[model samples]
Target chain A: MSKVKKNVWWLVFSLLFLLVLTVAISDQYYLLVSFLFLIGTMVPLYSRFEKKKIQSREIVFLAVLGAIAAASRVLFFAIPSVQPMTFVVIVSGMVLGSEGGFMIGATGALVSNMFLGQGPWTPWQMFSWSMIGLIAGLLKDSALLKNMRSRLLFGFVMGFLFGWVINLWSVIAYIHPLSWLAFIQAYIASFYFDLAHALSNVFFLWLFSSSWIKVMRRFQKKYGLLD
Target chain B: MHTVLNDVHPITSFCYYIGVMILSMMFLHPVFLIGELFLFILYNICQHNGAKMKQMFKGAWFFIGVIVIVNPLLNHQGTHHLFYIGRNPITLEAIIYGGLLALSFCCLMFIFLSYNLVITSHKFLYLFSRISPQLALLTMITMRFVPLFIRRLTTIKAIQKTRGIQMDSGNIKTRARNGMHLVQILLVCSLEEALQTADSMEARGYGVKKRSSYLRYHMEKRDIFSLILGAIILGICIYGKLKGFGDLQIYPSLGSFGLKGIEDVMLLILTLLFTGYPLILEGREWLWWRWQK
Candidate 1:
């Protein structure tokens, strides 16, 4: 119970930290603030993960899946910003549950970027991937997610969301004194890439959704992991 | 593995990574960023021995080149009128800012490349284990899995080729579908093994007690020296930034990047030296090697 309480406070503290960060980003400390905001989001997840006495195999499982998620990018290396990472994340969430999804997605982005090159986009990628996983996990049993078409549609939408999430760094850190019009223009320019990412995701999920979900679900039950 | 970088302790390398990351973002001025970029290019070339540097350029040249051209087009705010492009007006400030952006990104990209070279997966995991053992272990798993999965994917593709389900041939749709089918087979085949993996964990003491990492890095004198240097420079940069010395205000009108006073010059020099530490060290090492020969 105390562990859970400690986790909850971590949530509150991170939120407060984020609030302070937003104010700082608007002021002269934008660079520092931007960094802290990234750390703030990640800390809570770490604290929560620590609270649970998770076993080694579960950790290994999450790591393997995360690695798979990172390697998934290599398959789509030919295409600009198109990959099945998002699809895999959704399946992990739907079958293995929320934390499982979050771990794989966040870890995937974090480690892959370690190889491809880490930048200002690191924090945003971590946050966005984990959030996508968390949302999928929360709605794992929902009828919307249970519906095949809706799940595929969700993956498609999330693909665009991932692109937008990356673009946020440019919005806050790069563009000085924030102009909405320029922000919109940046989005407009990257629309094609985002569209390709979204469409490719829809294709992946449409074809392999059942098998992927079955694999994840069967593993979850047989091993009694992340229940 | 150029000069002293490879031999530097992992902790020092990690500190260097952190310091470089923050400094690149904090110092928005072009002069500082350009110098930093130059150092990175030099350091990268030194580390990779010129061969991989060409590949890095091949991959990154397009985006870096685009930044210099695109930023001026997208952002048109400055007093110094450079020229007219079509109907839109271009300004020196926008161009300069664009150049700074490009240079800073170059510095960042190079920093990470060096980071990958310096801090291996074992080092990264070592650091992670101290902070949060669970996450560190997970990262270890991830690091291991990436190479394993890639190898497995290739083998699966090879086997599937024997069965006549083509992977590389045919149209994009057919090729993509074939790839997905191969991935599906891989996933299902691995599911049973995943259970065994979990079973093995249960047999071994997984969450039995508080986990820890295998302590590999022992802090030496050089490690401590690097740590002190890293902290000092990071502190100075942060202090200078907060005091408005390194601030490049460009919202309403562009601020002067020119060294107005000795203090400004000192601040600039401080930042330049910190960022250029690798460049200076590598230069000295190269000269030393030549002299010895």
Candidate 2:
């Protein structure tokens, strides 16, 4: 098979393996931890073989990412009213592309949980935050940030969507009521935190996005990582 | 240091850890809390494995802090007065309850740390292989890679700092962007590592039928007894729970200790035994080693 075909096959196999393993475990904590490790290991591998530049700086970048991600949890505790992780996901997506963004967001949760300790709630948190990074990276690639208005608008929408998605997990794990009212209550409770994230995203895009793109381009040139 | 930590079977230790975790989640029984605290103190002071105990406690402090902060917030109601902030009231009952929860969490962590000390990953793999080969494989792989991912993350961060990336104090946006930059790099690195691991696993014929595990543990008479006792304790706890012996209630009267009657005492004893089985095994091993000395 061609290299592309080989990578794709590997991805498919690994993902299937993960799905089967998740189902088999039946314990959400084990499944989440297993997934985090699997993804943490797999994401880097995918990046290396994607005919990307293979930057030497990538390792350093990831470590810093992990620390920041870990720190975000502490920040959440410090300021329980805001969700800093959402902002982290968006920024990661813009810099690393979708796959990279997803890995960091997910793995960051895993690392945070190590200190926070594991529980049934981790898998949902991992998936929810990861989707944020993945979506941000995808949106960034699509030129949603071309203008200030569009960038801010996208940020606001993404922030609310992120909140809504995570709230879905809360509904599943807790709130056995599972009614529309329960959903709305969960959403409303999350709104303030989500609003913080959304405003932060817009501000982030306005302030450092151009510089971020420039840095990525420079890093790519210097280290020949991901074209 | 080595002898006291080396006696318990990994599976027994794992069971003990899981039992404690489940109990911590299900009920905040004060007896169990007290029992666990006493056990931790005993293990720390008397186990003859001072270094191991220190490490366990050091690692535990952060979790303790988390429990302290989160438990109060989650369980908002309690009777005894402490103070009140606006609508949210902090009660003495809540503080005591939170403290118990923290103790329970520490007990779970203690069990896990003890397991790590007594049961090497290789031993854990061997024990699991007998029951489920795929799960055994996955467990081993996860244990192996989690640390690697952490190490790699650290390396990535150091490298970024050297690259003159200003990661420190900025506006929320700048900080977030910096964080994203680091995450992007980490992801790329992780993907590379995963590919390498996959290649290695494939080369080694990991998923092949009839994989062999190096078994080092034999089921001795003591092991059998311990296992039997564990089964009985687990059975009784389940039976008692089903019978509504310790069904936690946080309502009107804040339901006075569920385990009030004689049957409740029996359930508490069984639960404590179940939760502390590993420590018991370890204690036995420590005694044996001391006698030999």
Candidate 3:
């Protein structure tokens, strides 16, 4: 475990080294921040996986759920941004707790992108989905998440938020100086896609969120997993 | 697997992507960018044939045209004014700038597509597993689970069809409900089976001792040859870049972009050899095939 721990720390430290290397080679701000933000999120998540002491049971559960999440993304391909990937992550958090939720979200994004084609957007997708899982996990104990109305509301809001975060990739890559006008224009244009995504998230949460939670909870109880 | 990239070590492939991406992004000079882009297309064609390369280029020309048409609309700058679009002046600098951007972006896209081809998922996980076996194993299993799950979904759908469950054709709500029901079945069946997987792993002594991956990828002679060749070409390009041979300045003004002399031409030639190394390797194989024939 300690040895495994060291590798994650190396992942964290290597970012600094990589930052120095990127700076020495290129004077571009976009390159610098992308590297920074990517590594910054990656290191913590790797450590979180380590700290959880997640066993084979939890891992298999996570992997299968992640598979379903990715498959669901494909299943809903015709519907345009309406998929249960985010919904699955959110419910995984509510049931399996925070880290488990985060794992499902991150892994779901990673596996889907592996099939879909990995690109600059891959890391950002992982980051966005992981955050949604993490946030949901943190709120699992609260009344807000426990209540169905608030959960649906949260899902709707998160739908829009996820799209906004994803929109950052285009801004980071193309639009230099990050002008407010240009940024707003891009955001405004993507509003419909974001709306569709958010609405779909709400739909999933409203419809199947409770049932998924029940199934996972029952499975975890039966196997004594994710404790 | 037949591609030249399939033969190179993952480390080498990783370096190639990073190098090409950084270069494609950093080198704004049309000479360097054009040469890079040309070799990228040539290499892509050689590796994936015209079909895959053309698939990549689908709508690419349209994108370049968009950049050429749209950049000047948004940005009104530079002394070399070309024409006007409504209220804005479309300057020569803006057009040139947009063209450079379009070219470099195409090169970048090629680099990414090549990466997708070269560093397949198992290789990527293999690289990561060297660092953290636990997380990498989880990710590898998750990646495996996707295709496996998809296959299972189709099987279940087929089984459901026998039972009068029509998922393939229905109203939107009905179709969506069937999808959810199919997913629910997947959840229950997979989770139930996951217990067996965990038991098997535990039986195999997983998580008890430090795990080590057994895949053996060594630096063969060709790997070493390509590595050194790659390093030398990369060194020269970076040195040239450092020496300001590949600079393409834009903004308040566009700077002179001329080849200084023989060194510049030789440098460009070196870059061609460097960028086109994949094509060289693939062509060598092609020649060997011809000789065999």
* Candidate 3: docking tier: medium
lDDT of 1 at B18: 80
Q: Rank candidates by DockQ, best first.
A: 3, 1, 2
Q: What lDDT score is found at residue A117 in candidate 1?
A: 63
lDDT of each: 0.76, 0.59, 0.79
Ranking by TM-score: 1, 3, 2
Model 1 regions more than 4 Å off: A1-31, B49-51, B69-77, B83-89, B204-213, B247-257, B279-293
Per-prediction DockQ comes to 0.55, 0.08, 0.58
Q: Candidate 1, which CAPRI tier?
A: medium
Stretches of candidate 3 exceeding 4 Å from the true structure: A1-28, B59-70, B84-87, B161-165, B239-244, B260-267, B284-293
Model 3, span A1-227: residue lDDT tens = 79857975887677667777766876567555776766686677776686666678778888888888887886676677788899999998888777787888888999898887787778789988988998999799999999999999999999998988887876556544345765676688789989988988887788888888899999989989876
**Candidate number of the best DockQ:** 3
TM-score of every model versus the real structure: 0.88, 0.53, 0.87
Give the clashing residue pairs of candidate 1, or none: none
Query: Which 10-residue span in candidate 1 chain A carries the lowest summed lDDT?
Result: A170-179
lDDT of 2 by residue, A33-110 (tens): 444554654455444433443232353344445445555554445555354455556666777777667756766665
Best by TM-score: 1
Error of 2 at B104 (Å): 5.0
